[model samples]
Target chain A: MRIVVDLNRCQGYAQCVPLAPEVLKLNGEEALTYNPNPDDAQRLRVLRAAAACPVQAIIVDQLDLKK
Target chain B: MSSPTNGNALKDKGRIVIVGASLTGLRAAEALRKEGFSGHLTIIGDEPHEPYDRPPLSKQVLKGWVPADHTKLPRMLEVHAEWRLGVAATGLDRAKKVVRLADGDEVPFDRVLLATGVRARQWPNPAQAALEGVYTLRTSNDAARLQAALAAGPRRVLIIGAGFIGSEVASVCRELGLQVTVAERASAPLAGALGEVIGAIAAEMQRDAGVDLRIGVSITALEGDASGHVRRARLSDGSTLEVDVVLASLGSIRNIEWLEGAGLAAGFWGVGCDAGCRAFDIHGIVTDHIFVAGDIARSPHVLFEYQFLSMEHWDNAVLGAEVAAHNMVCEEIERRAHLLVPAFWSAQFGVNIKSVGVPSFGDEIVFTQGSRKERRFVAAYGRRGRIVGAVTCNNGKWLEYYGAQIARSGPFPPHPAGFDLPGDMRVVPAEFPARGVPTAAPDVVLTGHDPSERHAEFRPRAR
Candidate 1:
């Protein structure tokens, strides 16, 4: 599974970090660091983290799809 | 009208109606389609615009960094649903499974999701509230109007109430170099949400930022000029302030009045729902066809001693909508629980304020880390001996750590993080405002103590 977070839209609420700890992390207060791809075993956790984002900055498996 | 069927009878081929086309409604529609529900979907909204993000309206929009019209929420998936905008849901006929609309229309459905949310409370006096300079920030239009008014350069801006919205607007005024005064009835700003201890810190932040802070006072009356524009505000302490703009940031009101005769467990606190987001009847019996989400959903939390909680935060709305959508389409055994630990964030006075769990449920509080004098700290709230909530001001990097402790119902004064400890670790009263004081306590409400007291009168044959 692949995931991408729009850094500009991300406000570092850190809500996603707790939901997907291994894949996503907050470097400091505002800077967010995350893995772009992960094993399918963590799909549900990644999706939940994506949905819980207040700004909906996280996108899963939509990187290649055209708008 | 057809009778309501058992939960499993209608899975993906039935009609589904969703009331309120905001964040929760839009997310639910997207989730419903993702859950493989190929049914006819209808979304009804009173507002004309499509679903939009509301958080930025007070912060970036008011600051003129972002336009109000550009706050629309991004569409995650293509939801091919019938859209009904600029029309209000007048009533609900549970027996007939139909939603009455204001434009003399009726929409039938096998299942429905109510995400009506809340509206900003208006000034009490109609005439004074109708004045030219009076405004309340809730929708995109309100932000646009207020932004223009601020850009016009009002002589002095008087803001009533010191809630999150009010305080955020005050922050924007100061950033714009406008003269602003905040009048609050509580002992300190944010006393209703974070309690007096943390509220005191917030009060200092506002004052240090050049805000004319006035506590323990309320605006008794608003005097206006002959042109129907607000000029001066009279205070309870016999003082008047000359002002050109007035913002009544007096919190919000739940949008559940239209469901009065619907026989749902709805009242001043909001509509009641179970763990699966199923709406409860007047007799506390869960209904199969109706679900609740967003700010209008009041459900019990296992973490907070199973007390029914109503959370008006972005996280709760999104999480609750997904759960409600899943339950609406799946069988009972395949349903999921909406067990979201309440969380929220506010940016004001150059500080990033964030919190997890229900802060109002805690009786005692202690600053565990960071420096309070510098306005960058983390305070943990404890009830009995368990940590119930934590607030971080400009110290949100530790929010996830504290949130973990709250989810586990960890011990109070939770063993210090082994670093950045405060000089004094003494626990003190949280000092929440007394009941009956109209404050910003709506963000997280522990509705009633007795579960049985939440039920309404069941008049089965009233119609």
Candidate 2:
């Protein structure tokens, strides 16, 4: 699974920071600073982080095995 | 037209995504489940905590009667669903049927509900906003922090807005035996919502409560200590007040950034939706799968001549959530309309102020029942010779009757029995302040911008 965040729309609400701190973090200015693509093992954390966004800004893409 | 037999098409439970995990989101979730929605349910929120009550934050919580975190809203029923706490939705991909989050993850949903509420508007100047002692009250954490600061016993408290929150803060300050000062950009307190005459009464109430109320004054600059703690505020009227704490209760901004390219009928005013809670796109086309509710939801009112109304009251959140929930899972024919009349209340300065309907929609006001001097009166607001709103000071019992009349589009100066009728029955101009300007209270605004643009403007820009 791969995660792709649109930095332009994130307001750094930090709702995802707590849910998946390893993947999503906030900078000193409190803007959302996150990893674009995490390993497959951290897929659940990525999903949870996406679910926690109030503005629904996060997006997770399932990797296709054939590709 | 046999009722558009699409019930069977929706029988297969679909994924429902609700943005915002506050009062409206929680209640709507419970409503969806209660209405037999077995589809996958996902609730997304920017706050880490579960949905909680916000009304008590300014009153009981701040007064130390209840802890801010403990002011959780009572769950009417259990809503078993995926709890997405702490992440913010950044974009909406309507064609893909997905909601994008900041972490670059997308949640696929057949239907979506935009319950993302509003946030407290901050002071414009970055230097003043960065001052440590200056604060804006909106979230639970904000209330908790401010409550602790107030308990620390600052020398004096200065409030820069006289809206309900600011007024209530002053009332709380009095209860705490602390000296308080209120400065408003408007001509009088509550002039934006209730107009000049009623605003004058409110201004008097604040003065009577010993608040150094200053109207028609704007904060030019906020001076801070060496450590960046606010020390004094310079007013536009060429006066400065030495204060230890400063609170800016300017108003609130809707939380709508996530719907940037989702291309819904969303703007600065809020996401436009029908009375049935279904969201409309920019072109005004209603989509069945998308819905909206709560403080962020803007819909038209039948009683107010089909003018879109946006409300931030607690009652509207509860009522709007229920209606949105019912319409989300049910068929179009079985769906319900969210025509709930707006109502709100505030306990300040030994007065229990309650109001039904949107007073700003009214053009005139009359002292229908009780006297303003006694601080126990019911003022009726009229628009085009019909009662549209009513407010009662320390007299809430008569609100229901007036509310019903407003809901039913009753006559101006509603004549409910048991009140002395004045032979001269005249209505006076409310003299409300112009829209989109600074005032004492939060005006229901339509920001006419995408959620993303709204948030971007608030972001600290590089020099």
Candidate 3:
């Protein structure tokens, strides 16, 4: 799976940080920081994080290819 | 990714109707498909537009970072269902299995989900409420209008109540360099939610942010010019402010009037439902088909002494919708319970406020981590020798840990600190003022919106 986070649109709601800590996280300044390429094992959680965002700032695509 | 979830996967089955086509409604529609409920799914909403994100209305939308119209909640999962927008469900015929719409259309369903959320509580005085320059934020249109009004640069803005919405609006006013005053009948801002201890700090934060913080006071009356534009407001202290804008942030009123003759267990506290999200009748008997979710759902929480809690947080809406949808199509044994932990977050004045569990249910608070003096800390709220809730300010990392402890119903002021604590980590009494306390001024009714605020007064009569 591929992960894309819109840093410009991220207002640091930090909802994604908890749901997908392995893929998305917050920096020391509390700004959003995340790994664009997460392991395949983190697919479900990463997608869940994308759905959880109220701002819809996170995008997870390319699910059919698996790994 | 998953292309689109096909509700047809489960084959044609019983009809499932979801009311309130907003966040909860849309999510519930998707969940019905995810849970293999292929029945005829119909969604009815009062709003003309699709479901939009409301959390940004006060923060980013007001700050102009995002246009109110652009805050639409993305439909990540395709919901193949009949969409009936711009119409409200006027009544529910539980016995007949029909939902009456405002347009006189009765949508029949094998099961129905009530997600009719709350509306902004208007000013008591109709004349004062109708005056120009007075506003309330509950919908996207409201945010847009308020945004335009703010952009016009009013000389002074008076926020009548210092609740979350009011305080956030004040923050935006200051961000826009507008002179702002915040009035609260409580001793401090957020005192009703966080109790006087944390509320005092919030009051200081507002004052420090250049807000004219007026505690223990209320607007007696709003005086307007001949053009019917509100220009001034009379205060409880016998003072009048030359304010151009007045925000009636008195909180929200649950939208349940339409269900008046419907005979469902609904009132000011919203619709009563079992843990599985099945609606309860007036006699407290759980219905088999009718379901309830979102900010409108009042369900029992085992964490809080089996008391029915109605939470208005964004997370609650999503979680409740999924659970309700799952239980709607499943049998008794396969049903899922909407046992939400009641978490919420808010950002204002450069501070992030996040909480887990029900803080208002606790009797005392302890600063388990960090220091309040430094304006960053974590406090645990305890009740009956158990940690019922925990709140964090700029300390989000530890919230999940605290949430686990709260879920375990750990001892009040859990020992060992678990991590580093301030030198004086003393457990102090959480001073929750009596509900509906008599204010110093008769004109100002300080509504303590604890989510379950009016439930105590509502349940007895509902029974």
Candidate 4:
């Protein structure tokens, strides 16, 4: 799975931080700093982070080897 | 979990894409899961941050009592879905059943929810807006930076636009022991939302709070120092105010530009939707797959004769989200309507101000309980003989009763309510003059422009 974020629209609401700490983290200024790639073990947490976002800026996609 | 192989099973479940990661969007996702929606859920937002509370931005957060980052809203339950953060939905391809992202990616969906909220309207002058000392409060970072500036103890703060946010900012400045000057283009504060009679009381409150309340004046230009820091502000009345910091509480612009070619019923007033939260197209045709909620959702109110109404209140977002969510998954026979009465509250200048119903919708107002002179009162608003709205200052306990009256379409003047009237109980015209240009008393305005102009602007744009 791969995750993508648009920095311009993100207001740093941090809804993704609590849901997936490994993927989404808040910087010193409290801006939404995140990781686009995570281990498979944290897949569920990343999905939950995307769903919990108020501005819905988190996007997760499934990777296909055939494609 | 194994993927569904049955075609009939997959047909029953459909994907839902919600834009604008706002309070309404989050709540709707949660409500969808709770209501047994097992379809693919994808949420997209332009803001990188998660959904947070906005009301606190002007109050506790600005007052330095609470940090802006700490104002995050509490989630009631878990919502399982895909998240698309920090990316904007550039276009809505209805035919393709996909939302085009700014990054060129597309998310396929069977249903879409438009929850893109409003943004702070900035100063007209780009140079003035770029000044270090001039600020506008809307998002968390705005509040955070403003709070830090206020903590530094600026000598004086000049607040332009005496609306709710402006007034609240002034109140916070006073509490912080900093000199504050409030310049209002309107004659009295809150005249836009509450009318002249009630606005007069609010004007008195500000004057008593030691605010340099300047009414009927417009800011001509902002004078900045060598470092581009605001030093003073010049008004149209041939007067200048010396200040180190300035806060512009002009108003907000709805997030509708991205939906330009979406062919949806989206405009400056917001995206038009049916009572069931279904979005409408430019031709006034309702679309079942696309819904709207929060500040961006404009739907008709049964209590207000089905007049399409849009509210920016916090409560409206939660209620509208739940309704939108329920309607998204339920069958037509089981779908519900989003008809919740609007309510909002604000804390400023040591007074707890709360209002129930749409105060601006009323034509006449009456003092139903308490005394306005005492700085505590419950004023009832009526439209065409029916109670439509009510505002309370330090007397919010009576709002529930007034809200019920509004909901039931109760009568005007409400039969005295075991309280003494001003001898004449007749409800008179509220006399809410145009905002921006001052004429008489104070008023809380919902929009920056005059109410009449808003109506004119909300008309369907020519093709």
The candidate that achieves the highest lDDT relative to the unseen native structure = 1
Pick the winner on lDDT between candidates 2 and 4.
2
TM-score of chain A of each: 0.88, 0.81, 0.84, 0.82
Query: What is the DockQ score, from 0 to 1, of model 1?
Result: 0.07
Could you say which candidate leads in TM-score? 1
- Residue B103 alpha-carbon offset, candidate 2, angstroms: 2.2
* Clashing residue pairs found in predicted model 3: none
**Clash number for candidate 4:** 41
Predicted candidate 2 versus true structure: per-residue lDDT over B1-463, tens digit per residue: 2221244334345788999999889888888877777778899999999877676688767877657776555454567789889999898888888989888889988778899999988888988898998899999899998999899999989998998999989988988988899999899987887888888999998998899999999989999999999999899989999998888998888887667567677766789999998998865778978899999889988888999999887767878988988877676678788887887776677776778888999989888777677777788999988999998776666777888899889998777546754343568898888887323331223444777554211221232
lDDT of 3 by residue, B1-463 (tens): 2111223332357788899988799889888888777668899989998776677688777876556776666554667889999998899887788999999999998778899899998887999999999999999899998898899999999998988899889988998899999989988888777788888888888998899999999889999999999999999999989988889999887888788767577867788999999888765778887899988889889989999889998778888999988877665677788877888776667777778898889989988888787767889999988999888887766777888888888898875456768777788988877788323211212245785562221222321
Q: Count the backbone clashes (under 3 Å) in each candidate.
A: 0, 39, 0, 41
Give the lDDT of residue B235 in candidate 1: 99
By lDDT, the better pick of 3 and 4 is 3
Q: Candidate 4 — which residues are off by over 4 angstroms?
A: A1-67, B1-12, B419-426, B435-463
Off by over 4 Å in 1: A1-65, B1-9, B437-463
Listed per prediction, chain B TM-scores read 0.94, 0.91, 0.92, 0.90
TM-scores across all candidates? 0.86, 0.81, 0.84, 0.80
Evaluate model 3: give its lDDT.
0.80
Q: Candidate 2, what DockQ?
A: 0.01
DockQ of each: 0.07, 0.01, 0.09, 0.03
Query: In model 2, what lDDT does residue B161 have?
Result: 92
Q: Which regions of candidate 3 fall more than 4 Å away from where they truly are?
A: A1-67, B1-11, B416-418, B437-463
Docking class of 2: incorrect
